[model samples]
Target: MVSFKEIKNDLPAGIVVFLVAVPLCLGIAMASGAPLFSGIIAGFVGGIVVTLISGSQLGVSGPAAGLAVIVLHAIEGLGSYEVFLSAVVLAGAFQLALGFLKAGSIGYYFPSSVIKGMLSGIGVIIILKQIPHAFGYDESYEGSLHFMEPDGKTTFSLLFDAIRYVSPAAVIISGLSLAILIFWEQILSKKGKIFQIIQGPLVVVILGIVLNLLFLNVYPEMALSANHLVELPVADSLGGFFQQFTAPDFSRVLTYEVLFLAGTLAIVASLETLLCLEATDKLDPYKRISPANRELKAQGVGNIVSGLLGGLPVTQVIVRSSANIQSGGRTKLSALIHGVLILGSVIAIPGLLNMIPLASLAAILIVVGYKLAKPALFKSMYRGGWNQFLPFVVTVLAIVFTDLLTGIGIGMVVGIFFILKNSYHVSHTMLTEKTPAGKEKYRMVLAEEVTFLNKGNIMQTLRKIPANAELEIDMSRSAVVDPDVRELIEDYKNTARSNNIKLSIKETAEDEKLEYEGMKF
Candidate 1:
C-alpha cells in the first residue's frame, strides 16, 4: 500500500526533478529536430499520464535524451512529422501489449552491476555531449548520438570552435547561472529554513530568465532570439486550445516505411525506458522495485498522448528520476504537478521562458552529467570485480563510441556470457547410504544436472567407489544426464563385475541399458 510518509519524503526530489526535466525535455526535442513543443508535450504526458499507472513511487518519466537519435531519423524517414506521430501512437499500443503479456520479467534478468554501469555511462555521455551546448555552440544537436556529426562538425571540434568564437552573452549567462546554482546548493541550502526549502536550480532558472529579460530590455540587439526559448503552441482561448491536437497520418500506417519506423521507435524507446527504470530503482532511497510491465503501459500511454499532440516519444529518464529521488520526491503528484507547471508555462508564460538563456540550462545538465559519471562510480565498479567492471566499462565505451542501443546490447551480451559461465560451473553433488542388511540393499542418488560440464566430477566419484560392495547410482532429481556420464556409469557397472559388486541404478526415469545386463562399458 502507498503511504503518505513516503509521499512527503519525495516532495523535494520531485520538485528538483521537475526543474531538471523541463530544460531537458526542451533540449532533447530541439536536438531531435522535432517541434520543441513535442518535447514539452512528452514531458507533460510522461509525468501526468505515466504516473497514473506507474508502480514506482518516485520514478519520473519524460522525453529521454537517449531517444533523440531515433526520433530524428524517424521524423526524416517517415517523410512528414505528422505521419511519424501516427507511428508513435501505434508504438504506444505495442508497448501496452507488452505490459499485458507480463514481459517485464526480462528486467530481472539484468545483473545489478551492468545496470549500474549503464546509469553511469549515461551520465558520462550527458556531460560529454553537453559541453558544446554549455559553451553556446548550437551547431551540434543536443543529445546527439555517439558517432553523429552535425553539419559536418564533430562534437569535439565544435567545442574548440565554441571556445574560439565564444559568445560573451552565452558565457556570462552560463557562468552566472552556474555560480548561482553552486552557491545556492552550498550556502543558501545551509542558511535559514525558508531559503533551504527553495532549491538552487529553481532559483538559478528563475534568475536566468530575469537576467535574460533585463538584457532584452536594455541591449535588445545582444539578446537571444525567441527561437531559443521554450516555445509552446498556445491558443488565445479554450476553443483554440481544443484545436491544438495533431492528427496522425493514418493512411501511411499500412505502408512498409511507416511499419519500419514504428518498429524502430518501439524497440529503441522500450529499451531506453526499461534501462531508465532499472537505473531509477537502484537510485531509490527506499529501494522500491518498479513493475516493468506497468511502466511500459504507462509510457505507452504517454507516447500516445504526446504523439497525438505532436510531441516526442517519452521514456523513463534517469536524470529526472535521480533528481526526483535526490530532491525528496515522494509521490506521482510531483510528476503530475510538474506537468501542470509545464502546461501552465506554455499557456501563460512562453515569453517569460524565452528570457532564460540556453547556456544556463546547459550548465544544469553538465552538473547532472557529472553527478552521474562521478569518479566514485568508477572506483566502486573496479572494486566489485572483473565480472562487474568489464560490462560496466564496455557499456561506457560502447556508448561513447557508438549509440545507446549498441552499448546496451554489447553490455547485455557480456552479461549473458557471465550467466552462462556461472551456470556451467555449478556443481551437482549427491550422497547415498547403504541399508543395514546382509542382502545387497542399496540407496542411490543422482547429481543435480548430470550435464557434460559435470562429467569429470561424476567420473572421479564413480572411479573411487569401493569394489565388491553393494552399489547404488541415483539419477533421481537430475534434469540432464549427458551421454558421456551415462557411458561412465555403464563402464563402472561392467568393471565392478570383476570385483563381484552388485550395481543398482535408481532414477525417476529408468533406462534399460543402464539398469540391466544390457549395460555395456
Candidate 2:
C-alpha cells in the first residue's frame, strides 16, 4: 500500500531518526544497567517488528527512559539481567491482555492540560539531562530521565559540575553541530534537492566523526576519549554477534517476585506507551489518530521479541517518535528503515559508530527538547487562564522534579480537583424572584446529568427556599437524576407542604409525575 514517493520522503527522515536513535538506545541501555547490545536489540525490534504491526504512521517505539529506574531496580532485585528479561516477556503477555480487554481507552481520559504539561516536562528533562553530555561530562549516563542522579548528584548540580569541567573539544563539536542543525532547519533545508535529501542530524553526526578524527591527528590534545564516544559492542564474527543475544531464564518465570515485577513493568510500560501514543498523535502533522489498543498489541509484540533477544523492555517512546515527526517521516517505513540502519550499524560499522562524539548527539536532542518546551507554549498556556494553566504548570514541574509517571499522576490529581470544584458549583441553576403581582416565585433547573457530587448543593438550595413561596422544580433537561437527589426532592416536597408552600414538579415528556405523598424514603 505504500508508494515510492512516500518511501522517498521516509528514507531521509528515517536516516535522521536513525542518527537520533543510536545514542538514545545506547544511553538508555547504560542508564538501565543493561547490556548496551540490549538497547540496540530493543530499538531494532521496535523499528522493524513493532512498526510493521503498529497502526501509528509517525510513532516510533523503543526502550523508554521513563523505565530506566524500574529496569535498574528490577535487575538488582532479581540478581540477574536474564531474570529481569523474563519479566519483560511476561509483561508483554500482560500488555496483550490489556489490549484485548479494551483498556487502552484510558489514554482518552487523560486531561489535555496534563498531557501538554507532560510534553513540556519531558522537554525540560531532556534539555537538562543532555547538558552534562553536551559539555562532555560523561559521569552520568546519557538518556537518564531522573532528576536525582544515581551517583548522588541532582540534575541541576550535574549542570553546574559540567560547566566547571567542560571539555573544550566537546564544546566546539557540539557548538558547530548545533549551528549546522539550525542552519539546515532554517535555510539549507529550503534551498534545493541536495539539501532536502541530506538531513541535518545525519550531517551533524558525520561532521562529529570526521572532526573527532581530525582532532586525533592534528590536535591530539583536544581529542575526545572513548568515554565520550558511542560504544557499540563490536563482534569479530557472525557467531560472536549471535552470542551477544541473551535469552530469558524460564526457570524464574513462576516465582512470585518475578510475576509481581512483570505485572509492574506491564502497567508502567502500558501507561507510558499510551501517553506517548497520545502525544505522538498530537505531534503528527497529518493529525492521524492511532488506534490505542492496536498500539498496545504492537508494543507487546516488540517487548516479547526484545526480551527474547536479551533487550530492554519496549514502549512507544516520545523522544524517538517526536524525532520521526520533526524529520518529515510520513509512514511506518521510516521507522522500519531506522531499525534496519541500527542493525546494520551494529553488524557492519560499529567501529565507525564508536567514533561519534556524544556532544554532537546531545546538541541534536537539545534542539528537540527546546522545540517541545518552547517559550511560546508556556506563554500560550498561561494566557489560557488558571484552569488550564495550573494543570499545565503542575504537570511540567512534577515531571521535572520526579519521574514521568509520578509527574503525570500529580498533574492528574490537580486536574481532578478542578473538575470536582466545578461540578460542585454548577450542579444546578436556582433563581428566585418576585412577579409583578408581588408573588414570590422560585425556579430550580436541574443539571443535564446529576450524581452524588451534586447532592450537597441540591440539598442546600432546597433548604433556602422561603416559606409560602411558589416553588417549581424542573427536571425536563436532566437525562440522569441520582437516587439520592430524587429522595431529597421527595423530602423537600414534604417540607414544602409543612411550610404551606405550593410545590410542583415539571417533568420531561417521557417522565411520569412523581406522587410526592406516596413516595417513601
lDDT of each: 0.72, 0.89
Query: lDDT tens digits, residues 1-521, model 2?
Result: 33356887799889888888988898899989899999999999999889988899988888899999999999988899999999999999999889888889999999989999998999999999998888998888877778888877899999999999899889999999999999999999899877877888889998999988999999999999999998889999999999999999989899999999999999999999999999998988989999999989988888899999999999998988888888878898889999999999999999888898999999989988988999999999999988889999999999999889999999999999989888988889988899777878888999999988899998998888877677888899999999988988877877987776778788885677543332223
lDDT (Cα, tens digit) per residue for candidate 1, span 32-53: 8787667888887888888877
Candidate 1 stretches greater than 4 Å from native: 1-15, 145-147, 179-192, 210-244, 428-521
Q: Estimate each model's TM-score.
A: 0.81, 0.95
- What candidate 2 gets wrong by more than 4 Å, as runs, is 1-4, 497-500, 510-521
- How good is model 2 by TM-score? 0.95
lDDT of 2 at 182: 95
Collision pairs in model 2: none
Evaluate residue 366 in candidate 2 and report its C-alpha lDDT on the 0 to 100 scale.
91
